[model samples]
Target: MDTAKVVATFSVGIAATLTATALQVGKPSGWDELATGLLFAAFLAAIVVVVFDRLTDANHGNLIQLAFVHGWTQERLLKELQAATIAAVDANSWVLTAVRISTVAQVGISTLSGIVAVVSLLT
Candidate 1:
């Protein structure tokens, strides 16, 4: 999770830098404009990852709190904890999947944008 956060953060920064570089091409036509658009899309994807990550963390925290709500025998508490754990995992699976997909897209798009920006410079 920490690694994902770091990578997403780095991706966001790279997208911003590349977008700025693309814009520096003055009129920014052809590949330069496409690079800028793709960079913006990558930036939005990274932001989505960040938002999903925060929501996942919050969900986990909520599950933890709900699992330990006092009152109940040790056996009952264990059972409840197990059930909550399973339910939380099931519910959060999609969110985790989204974060993974968004992170991959963000990095991939940023790399492509960087390449396009370079190509624009050469052309």
Candidate 2:
């Protein structure tokens, strides 16, 4: 689905970015800062993933997301989503806005973690 696309694209982009950075900066003389940055990035990613995974859950997540669907029938689910898709389309502005917001928030949190790791390494 679109969400997965966004996630994958962002991940690849970030990985590319980090690779370029590592090449330019080379490994630090000591593990102190690099370790710190890794820890920070991991922690931030973990927190964001937990939050979003909860949102993605079928039960006890967003009520509006559940209400928009007519049923879980294959035909209905397929109608909202193309084959091999994991997300449904919503015409509602609010639903779209929420998804976009969630995407940005997840990215922000993951970036924060990477930043922390870098700063720790630098120090």
Q: Candidates' lDDT values, in order?
A: 0.74, 0.47
Q: Tens-digit lDDT track for model 2 on 7-71? A: 73475356335533543565554433454454455445534444443233223233335535644
* Candidate 1 whole-model C-alpha lDDT, 0 to 1: 0.74
Candidate 2 pairs with clashing backbones: 33-120, 33-121, 37-117, 41-113
Highest TM-score model number: 1
Residues 7-120, candidate 1, lDDT per residue (tens digit)? Answer: 977876776676677668667778877988888888788777778874322244554565577555667666766776787677788878888888888889878887888777
Off by over 4 Å in 1: 25-27, 54-71
Looking at candidate 2, the ten consecutive residues that score lowest on lDDT are 53-62
Residue pair clashes in candidate 1: none
Task: Give each model's clash number.
Answer: 0, 4
Best by lDDT: 1
